[model samples]
Target: MFSHHGHGHGQYQPPATGPQHEPTFKIFCRADEGYCLTVRHDAVHWYKDMRHSTRVKDEEGHPAFALVNRATGLAVKHSLGQSHPVKLVPYNPEYQDESVLWTESKDVGHGFRCIRMVNNIYLNLDAFHGDKSHGGVHDGTTVVLWEWCKGDNQCWKILPWGPEAYAPPPPPAYGHQAYPPPPPNREPGHGYHPAPAFYPPQPPPSHDEPGYGYHPPPGGPPGAGYGNRLPRALASEPTVRILCRADEAYSLTVRNGAVCLAPTNPRDDFQHWVKDMRHSTSIKDEEGYPAFALVNKATGEAIKHSLGQSHPVRLVPYNPEYLDESVLWTESKDVGHGFRCVRMVNNIYLNFDAFHGDKDHGGVHDGTTVVLWEWCKGDNQRWKILPWFCFWRDEYCSGLILYYSTMRCSRPLPPALLPPPLPLPPLAAKAVEVVPKRSERIAAKMALEALEGPIHAVSRAQRNLMRKLGLVPERGPVTAEAIAAYNALFSKPLSQEHIIALSSLFSGSLPPGKAAEALVVCG
Candidate 1:
């Protein structure tokens, strides 16, 4: 038995065989959510975060996040009960999603980024599996070190810190460990269990364990005088932003007795900096008139030296053409975001079903063209997708993804997100079918009478679905079937929205998740 020597504060470990250095791990990852897993004891532990429940069917805290060891189909998820560590034996890997974003690399100096939007709080690569926004960057950039990217193996192994690192994670009270005070009367043969009487005596907390009930991150600046304010017990985690000044690579961690780096000069790029008139710090310009000035904290004056000679202020880019398409359409303003023009569509904008020469870049008007590039704004290139799809759907609501096959390869739209909400919906029913307004009743009558036009594939699918859903009687033309189906579908005077949700069967641009909402259940 041993204890710390003098003031050295060294941890004395007796001989037992498990890896010595403690490590950190991420347990769960989702794009919109932040923290998923943290290293506690020798094992990784997980707890549900608010952002996660919105994306998946989280039944309870029971199954916090999925973990699996490749060699075994199921890996036991180890947890801490009130006292001892309890192991929930083997869980299926297929049901659980796992990614070794940071591998145990041999590359010592190599850096790793925290996937904030998905896993940790620094960098995010991919949010959705099926969508284009896989990583923060689209051109196949792995934002962090992963085994898949074929980088040096060291990319995965991140060294937590130096010798004087954050204090060690609390020791696990294994099932075999004994409690304090031994026992009131030690029966010669029997040992103590974690019963009410055998509760392990807790050691007095050290300076590392903030005795004050304070959230350290928000507890003003580090080393600030919190002399009066202290928590009964410090936070279990204290987040630190780690940055490699050499590589500008960064990772953030809740320094929970684990050594991680610190962040560098972090700045928000959305601010505008205007110059001053005299160029002296003394002559200040109050820039909060039309917009607030991004000023230096030391001097509450204009950002640049002087204003006279064309001080290029950094204002947020308002280029409608450069903005995300959905945002542009909603705000009805062109922030000069990018939009590509195709000769086929003779326009610059995106449309999943927009028929054209199907080509790009100055092709002839054969409407059978090829070649596509990123969209940008020119009059010929000035574009926006129609915000309303057939009046009943949320247009462009991640509708950019089209599972189209020019050959056998399905081309997915870039910067698109995966089909969230599970099993992407089948295309909405009935909505795609062109319907005559009440004013066009005569036209509808004429169309029914003619019956000469080629039926579109979507329209045909609508007919089939209607028949399948028992909306129409068997063995009849689509118009007749439609009439019967419409009568059966509604009791109230249904609007187009209600009719489509109830009777839609068209297989066009439906988001995969809404397949059930748009389902036309067949007989």
Candidate 2:
């Protein structure tokens, strides 16, 4: 018999008695009769019908074990702070960190043990809306770290891992025809035994019911309530915004060729980046984390490190054939809540230099330049990467209904069906009002020429002009190989736009024919 009066602290027992092997087990919450702990899409949740087996491996010279999940092949880990939700992460045996290791307390009652961290906080099923009065053993309720209160929700019953534990029992046997005959080679009670009549077959819980398996995060979806969103892992070439964890308002932005921390502006093209798909075939860091070039949406340049402490990070033209290591980066060392360190080659990390002096002078404010610094385990170095679409969805159609309407309709929509116009910032609004004059366009072209300065100065502009004229296919990046391909296919005469663009490039110093020759030579 179990008593509920005491603190419930009992003698600790190893999950497995065997010395040479670790046994897999299922953790069933005592508060929820049939519900067992499982991981779905790397998020910890309780499921009655579906559950993953977990094995405990003894840590050398430590009392705890690394709780590894079979589904994701990851270890159950949690942040250091109390009341944080437990997460699944890649296990590193070389560095057996405390976050990935968990200890088992003595059985409180009926073989239910308290799984706790070394810090004394027990693994707890989160209460409904954080209300302690309501037992949060409902299906899909997240598991979090909390101080032990001797509640049944904190006590878990470890059973031998098997599908039969959660699988529905066979229908009550009526006659001999209900089950197949036993195997001929087996003994009388050896194999293919029919299910007991006393065990009733209960219907699985209906997932369609409200509050059954759908527990949306508080305050809705990450940014602007985009509705049910796909996980980052499922998205191929997801556009992202690198936001500094120290100051949520600031994000990694390309300004005047240098990469720095700037106030997050959703409308700014410089802030949005796409993971380069060209390097997708070979995009893993040293630690096996996904790595790629952060290609800017507006400039078509990739973020690159110049390879020294004194050099500030800059954006360079993106070329897949160059095989540049400086352009590659990876997100590693999860700090919590989708934040991690953006690490470059040679162990250099992206750091927000906020610390100035003892007194608070200038720290993490707007326009703070980001630099490549050594790992200091500071919060300034951790960054939260968010999908760019979350912040920029105002200008585009979102949600299934909107997508259906846009795809199905051919004519103009009714007033009620029309999407509301997106609000533009003051600068964007002002720029949209002005019409560009020919002189202004020429002056802009002149400015670009001055910036490039005589070293393949007109190559980019010419390539753009060729793309516009259909001289080159708009499929991939304009690299040296693309130029050679275009030259081989060059048979059509130059268009008027080409002559005009060429004249602008040379201040009309060369004739039309001479400029056309020069363009081919440049190619």
Candidate 3:
């Protein structure tokens, strides 16, 4: 049975889970607050998406992991400590599907963008299609946007100990296959299609903002950082480097007359640096080539920079508490990554009693940068933190106002240090399309239920009408499926009243069939 010790890949090994003390290493610490946690890892390095570090998605759009609750910030803890095995919380139904990257071409499911990459290099931008050929699929194969980036599929970091040293956790449903095979009968097309007249799906709207089809983002407030996004780079990029060779132009030596010293120092030749897959902290790939400068020091939020306007600043080492990893979720939810220790007039933290101004008055916009600083504890000093909605808890704001706000709203608050509760405009200009609201869903459900009776009646009427028209199916005792076929084939006027009238009109018919397959639409 082994035990956890030391740090990094070498020293961080957990016990066999039989009976051992697993060395505990802090993957992340939100100053003092904490929340949902997984088995800790000893070497989990996160990189920004644009940095071309993780192939999964740009760090801007997709974060490696996230923490919520009393601690509110966006930054990934790149584990450099040792490994320790830990048991996964059984049936963690609370598991959230965070966005790993942005869909340059299309959306996956929910609001998650669909795409793939190899290493940290860009490859193909595509949408996930179940079976049909929407873009350029063949064999009815489903295709999602995929770039040839490395480590894209390496979703989890596995760490197991001897018998008990629980540290780095295992994936859900441990000791079993995570992804089961598709149903045997289900064909692999754009999406599983039972029969004709049914296509898999349409590209989901990029942003769920009312009716604004699908905008690729940069479509919102300036600084609400969108982490881990994978956008394509323009072509015609140079592939060359200059080498320094202490050369004394040989061609000019003879013409000079005077004895000129020929180039004698050994020369160094520079070659084109190409992007490659290399695990690292802050910077995505450090082995082959780096999109941004490498981390001189990999401290917890000590390394990296945000890619500002040009490329934002290099991603500072992320601290999940301050920033979000998912680009779509962050943008939709409106958040940023990394927190700078702000200097203050009082030159201190944890002393909010004297806190006057705002905690984080300066907004954390899409490309905003924050370094630790000091400020007076007032509206100017108090900053609105996120994921944590406590008035002063850990500064995690989710659109809810503080308990003492004059407006007095008890829901989630958004954007820190708001002077007053001003109604924020809709996220989109046109109309932000969203899933049917609760009330709309309820209404739709009622409408669906109401259709049941009429549908039954309509089936009977249809059978009678078919008999009158002499086009009824040979099968007796018509089934709902059969009725559906009939309805679809005939295209009669469809309304609840019409269906009931038809049913009553043909009540004397032979066998009464059912209506269309039970539609389970909420609305």
Best by lDDT: 2
Writing each residue's lDDT as its tens digit, candidate 1 over 235-305 gives 12121222111111221111221112222222211111111112123211121111111221111111111
For model 3, what is the error of residue 279's alpha carbon versus the real structure, in angstroms, after optimal superposition? 5.0
Cα RMSD of all models vs. native, in order, equals: 28.3, 22.8, 31.8
Worst 10 residues of 2 by lDDT: 443-452
Which window of ten consecutive residues has the lowest lDDT sum in model 3?
248-257
Provide the TM-score for each candidate, comma-separated. Answer: 0.19, 0.30, 0.15
TM-score of 2: 0.30
TM-score leader:
2
lDDT of 1 at 65: 30
CA lDDT scores, all candidates in order: 0.23, 0.46, 0.22
* Order by lDDT, highest first: 2, 1, 3
List, residue by residue over 47-113, the lDDT tens digit for candidate 3. Answer: 1223232433332354222211101112222111112111111111122222222223233323223
Instruction: List the candidate 1 regions with Cα displacement exceeding 4 Å.
Output: 1-42, 45-110, 114-357, 360-523
Model 2 clashing-pair count: 0
